[model samples]
Target: ELFYPKNKQHWREWLFNNHHRKDAVWLVFYKKQSDRKTISWSDAVDEALCFGWIDSKVESIDKESYKQYFCQRKPNSTWSKINKEKIEKLISTNQMTKAGFKAVERAKQNGSWTILDQVEALILPEDLKQALAGYKNALEYFDGLSKSNKKMLLYWIISAKRQETRQKRINELAELAGKGQKPKQFR
Candidate 1:
């Protein structure tokens, strides 16, 4: 794992040092608030993703105003439209490091970075809602899903590689949910 500096001021220097590294590594950072003086997960994630890095599982060090952050560039990680937009902004602001630049270029060549998909969980777009609406039983069941169960459905729907595939999943989930079934693994 790699560790970025604690402040935004240290980003450039730290990035330069790790710019040439070929493999992904974690960068640790901290955020503090006026009230608690702590950094946020979103901030760390946004910054790390800009440099082609991803935020890994987190751990608590103590009850202090700080926590350890695990940040790394995942070569095979999928890109989300939201994160893709953030990376573009980082580039325009001259915040992207060379390794990050190469990663983006590679994604471009591979057609993974640019192709936007509904790759998030727990967000039900109108299309999916309409699809599920056709089945009243499923709709009722879907409405009764717990947050985690709903999120599983969302992840499945969003990760569908094809339109037909997603439709099929929606149907299946609806049928299962109609029977008051929670996502099997989730339940």
Candidate 2:
């Protein structure tokens, strides 16, 4: 269901009450068409993560507002550096719920908890970088892509669960980029 919280307190209350419910999906509204103030996305995310939820897809509802989808964090969901940092802060503040701690434990156990650095520090894996650099067409194409596109490509490679799979994906990505085509997942 969709939820519109005026501020962090309301969001916290909602998450505290609903975070344990597996069937719940929340679409949190932010911004407003009129003068009414609303909780900022950052604050909402803070509360959500404290309850072991993650923000997913977001959609615009009007000129002045949008809704962000939030769901329980799955066992293997990859963590973004930004979200990881926020979780750390929430932990230190003693805001993490039992469910939140369990999610962290699951991520740690599965080896995805610390896989990515902040976006600005993120680069394509060495093997992927070398492959691209060796192919002039791919190198040119990659250099021309927007920052988000480049990040998406690198992220896809990084998220691979095995070394062989990562290498295979890097090769495919290099070949696709060389041909001026987007990865199927990215496309």
Candidate 3:
């Protein structure tokens, strides 16, 4: 469902009433310059975290506003570094609801809470680095990529459980990067 929350409190009320039942919500937020006042994205995220929800894809609705999708955190959802910090703050501030604490506990029990944290500083694997070295353009392109893009590529490659799968991904990445393209998943 789409929601236009006027402010942080409005969003909090909506989540309080519907967080347990709604599968997802598309929240509309006004741009800073928009005449219509709305909750800022940062505040919205903090509020969602309080309810054990997470935000994902954002799409522009118009010049004035955009919509972001928020949903209940899945059992296997991996927590991001920023979200982990946010969770800590929320906990310290006593803003986290029971549902939010439950979600954090589930992640801790399943070991997803610290998985991303351990790899927060994504390192380029030697094998992938060697492969990219063979393609100068690929190396240059990979080097110039934004941190998030590089992290996504590295995570996708490293997350492969099998050695052969990881090697295949490295080769594919080199080939794609040589062509000045990112992985299809990222694109």
Candidate 4:
């Protein structure tokens, strides 16, 4: 369903009314201008998270607006550090719903509520750093990567499902960096 709530109150009301419906997905139309009289996207995301919803893809609608999709938080969904902080604030402020608290509890129990900050800080693992150091082109390319790209590359390697996979990815990533290319799946 698509909705264009003018402000946070409307969005909150909608969530309060519909949050228990597990099958629903919302595509919220958001105006993206500092001066506009609309709920900021960040505020919308915070509100959704408070109701145990998660934002997925965002699509540009036009020059002035975009649409962001929100759906029920799935079991075992990894919690980003930023969202964990947001949940803390929401709980302190008494905004989190029972559903939201349940989601938070699950994350706490499963240990997915942590920062993947090594990527953000661009602190390469010893093994990956050694591999890069051996290839001058890779080292130079890595040094020049924007923080976001560096995070993506490192997260890809760190999130590998197995040790052998992680090692393979590290090697492949170094070769790609040496060629001044991004991972094929990076956007």
Instruction: Judge candidate 3 against the unseen true structure and give its global Cα lDDT, from 0 to 1.
Output: 0.90
lDDT of 3 by residue, 1-187 (tens): 7999999999999999999999899999988888998998889999999999999999999998999999999988889889999999999999999989999999999987876763578678889989998886999999898988888888888678799999999999999899999878789
Residue runs of model 1 more than 4 Å from their true location after superposition = 1-4, 22-43, 65-71, 109-111, 114-116, 119-136, 143-151, 157-172
Please, what is the TM-score per model?
A: 0.62, 0.78, 0.78, 0.79
lDDT against the true structure, per candidate, is: 0.61, 0.81, 0.90, 0.80
Least well predicted 10-residue stretch by lDDT in candidate 1? 30-39
Which model scores highest in TM-score? Answer: 4
Model 3, stretches more than 4 Å misplaced?
124-149, 161-164, 171-187
- Superposed by TM-score, candidate 3 places the C-alpha of residue 152 at a distance from the truth, in angstroms, of 2.4
Candidate 2 Cα deviation (angstroms), residue 132: 2.9
- Candidate 4 C-alpha lDDT tens digits along 90-138: 9899998888888888877875555365665688988898877777699
lDDT of 4: 0.80
Q: For model 4, which pairs clash?
A: none
Question: Model 1: per-residue lDDT, tens digit, 91-126?
Answer: 888877666777778877876764345433455678
Give a tens-digit lDDT track for model 2, residues 1-187.
Answer: 7887888998889888878765456555645456766888888888888888888888888777778888888888888878889988999999988888888899999876866663346466678779887766998888788888887777878878799998898889888888988789888
Best by lDDT: 3
Superposition error at 12 for model 1 (Å): 3.5
Per-residue error at 8 for model 2, in Å?
1.1
